[model samples]
Target: MTAGNVVLGLCSYTHDSAAALLVDNVLVGFAEEERLTGDKHTAAFPERAVNWLLDTAGVDPHSVGLVAYNFDGRRYLDALAATEMYAGRDTTRDRAQPRAESFRKVHDRFGSRMADLRDRFRRARVVPVLHHRAHGLYSFASSSYDAAAVLVVDSLGEVQTTTLGSGRRLAGGGCRTTIVEDIADPASLGYAYGAVTEHLGWRRGDEEGTVMALAALGDPTRFRALLREAIPITDGGFSLDPRWFPLRVLAHDYPRVSAGFIAATCPARDPSAQVEAVHADLAAALQERTEQVMVHLARRVRSVTGLRLLCLGGGVAANCVAVGKIVEAGIFDEVHVPPAAGDSGTAIGAALAASLDNTRHLATGVTGRCYLGPAYPRLVLAENPRPGLTAHRPAAPAKHVAMKLAEGHTVGVFSGNLEAGPRALGNRSILASPLLPDVVERLNDTVKFREPFRPFAPVVLASAMADYFTLPQPAPYMSIASGVTDLTRERIPAIVHVNGTARVQTVTADANPFLTEVLTEFAALTGHPVLINTSLNVKGKPICGTPDMALDCLTESGLDALMLEGWWVSKC
Candidate 1:
């Protein structure tokens, strides 16, 4: 296998498909397919993402030397689809196509359906990585630890849903991951959470965050006994009770809970049905139970590896509440959860694992980076304003933004690079004063069009974060949900949830220069450094990625103004 200078990483054939490029083993660009395709958690091959990354970075397609795909199982699965298409019949029923013909079809299909992508890699060697291993690799490689325990959990990754391992940077350069334990499906803690999400009458993959928000409002004790019995903590690791859940995950099946479990608990609620106190209580129970399992897993990893630091990745790791619980448990001195901790981030993992002869595994301790996607310079944005809008160049952009927020006007910000993850750090965020009494209601009803129960996050100044929240560590990525102080609840009530906790994203001058200035100015004006920061997108849509997309959002949504690079825009 040739480890070449330019390695392109891809995560596809699953939701949140993305493309990441590594020039000389250095991560140059990363973007999700959803961002450009405007489909939330889209599973389509990231054609637009790849094109955007390549074009924005000015990398020639022919120059790419290696293609690293995150999912290894796709090789076997793609062949089945090819065989069916080759014979023009269901391969499972016919069983007539030969192995050679099937492989030939795979080869031909790559040259046709993926013609452009295949031709772009005419001189490149393609490699596949195991899904769980990639998740483990990303969290470890991106962390600042010399060596740390790694925990990766999701609904399912190829086969295993959870993996425990240790990672350490090599003395010479690149990093290495050593696997300790693997937990397969149906028994997965992540699937258990997803099952609960489905049972709560919400979309499993998309609305799990909503359920998490609902957990903050409910009584966990109501279903505490049932959940403890369903997912009891084991000596090695926790396992889901088969009596409560289906043995396997059936595609397109809602509420994969067993009949016995349904009879014991409650019937599955419809998506359109109103969420009641019982549903919230069940959500609270599921979240609490899930946190116990995570803490147990972390303790096991610590005992096995004797490492003080932990790096977490995958879908379950997206649960900031569980992350906060693990942090409070003190299993690790520091827990590193990247801005993009889910499957889309596996693209970065795949590239980091592959090394080139010339580059010494490009230094990718991107602990300070969230703005790492497509960026439009001031020059790129057309000075000519769009129809029905007026544009102006402010003397002090940050102060102007602060002034608008102080007046209770919600401002959409489109500046610098697009954030690589789900959270809108600042560059692509809708900012409002968290001090406003009805800010949440206004944003939910007019702009976001989201569920009222789902609370917005606060982008707080890093130096001021400790003054308000009981966070164990700095959360620049909004990856941990920590309890809010009384001062916070009194001052910035809009961002605080019923649980007296807030998902906070701390910002510093080094992390985001513009946002740092904006926060400083806002604090000076309102005597509060916090702002309600939500992703710059309408509900059910991906975050805005380009100037045109940002403009489209400003026009379609209830944003009072937009702070684009070098220009202030408002509807006439």
Candidate 2:
């Protein structure tokens, strides 16, 4: 089939459904379905996201020659069968409805539904890419490095859980990836982390970050031995002991695995119970073991591939603490993780596969930033002003917002395009002074309604990054965690985690002039250029994508004001 200039990528029928549109290898639009639907981590079809991408890019459906879906159900079922055989599981089942039959039924239904959606693009040829391969491609292709060792560790992608590969740009044009290793399903670092999250009375995939936060507060000395027995590092990869964890069964059933593991190892607590020492210790052990295993895998990848640069993808790459440890270990000269490293990012990967030949224009080899979602028009404030709120267009919106932030007031700053990934990088963020320690507690209680243990991130001026955090380079995506200097920690106590490290976003004037202006004004006011920057959304909700959603967040939360583009809207 002849391919067109525009390629549409869709990731759906799984968590964090998203869509991406690449026009002649340039990513013009991308968005997660949850942001538009107001559904958190929704697995539904990303029709709205696809529509928005097409509409925003002004690309006709017929121009989309390739429609790439991130999952291949047939391959997934085949992998499942292989996993069962590899694990020596029973293959016999009820004649009427076997386990494989159930999977096949769902696969057929989903494929049919997807085909129906493909009717919109009459000339497009739809294709499905392997899950982990998509992740690897996105990581390596979006990176600035010409060659790198790619590692993808996730709960499960088809039958594979982890993939180690190498990617390099071809001499002529485009890029190629070669898979060097694969860790099959049931023995996954992502599943292990999710299990630990569930045992700690948190949602599996959604609350792994909470577990990572709690781990810093506990001593893992006592629990490490037990966790090590469950997840042991092997020669090339790691293995989950079936006795300690029924990996095959646990992979499919979330509740049963968490319940069984807790019943056997620790006492199950109430859903709302405060995190106790035991919970913290368990989280600490899981985190420590996971980090060790990841380092082992990364070192192996580096040795095998002889590559200095490392690019990581999959859900496990979202673990900033683990990624930090890997970076600090010096296993790789440089480590790069995309802004959206999880499942949602696979959409970008699938699109890139079809658009690789045309990406020669991206000479820098690096994908720019996370600000690829829809942006609200500045004139919208004047067109549709909400009641009980007054909007004023200041001569310098950044300075006005910075002044509010200097006054210890939490302000929602919604400007430009929304961020594509989980972390908010100033565009759609809530800003506050990081010097006030009480601000963390207030933001948690009133604004975020999240666990206090989860620390806020800091946006620092790029020039001043070395003065604050011990980082090798600028982390524009907030993908790496670095330790704050003692003096810097003293200056900004609220942004420091219990471990004295922070997920820092370094902002440059050229890349983010608006945020840089705000930081400049803030530095004039407080003698520091750092401010607390968190996503502008409440707990269990996706980040605000539109002006109305931003206003709603400001109205519902305890924020003092909201900066929409050049206009400032304050509470009545």
State the lDDT of candidate 2 residue by residue for 1-572, as single tens digits: 13477788788876899998887667877899988888989998888888888888777677788888787766646634543444354322211133345456656766785686578677887877788878998888778778999999998887789989899987765678878999986688898888768767888888799889999998998688888988999998998865555534422532334344565568765669987888888888889999999999999899889999999999999999999999999999889999889999999887876566345432222366678888876445653366778888888888888888888889998888778789999999999898876988999999999998888999999999888999887788898889888768667778899988899999998878999999999999999999999999999888988787888898888888898988889877
Best by TM-score: 2
- Give Cα-based local distance difference scores for all models: 0.80, 0.82
Cα lDDT tens digits for candidate 1, 1-572: 23366778888766799988877556788898888777889878888988887786677777777777776654433334444443453312232255334444444553443444466588777766778877888788777788999999887775577888898877767666888988765468878888888888888887789999999889999999999988988887887775676554234533368777778667888988888998999999999999889999999999988999999999898898899999989888999998789989998877776542235553463545667788777444444478878888889999999999999899999989888778899999999999887899999989998788889999999999888899878898888988988898777778888877788999989989999999999999999899999999998788998788888899888899899886899888
- CA error at residue 272 for candidate 1, angstroms: 2.3
Per-prediction TM-score to the true structure, in the order listed = 0.90, 0.93
Give the residue spans of candidate 1 off by over 4 A.
1-3, 74-120, 253-255, 356-367, 379-387
For model 2, the local distance difference test gives: 0.82
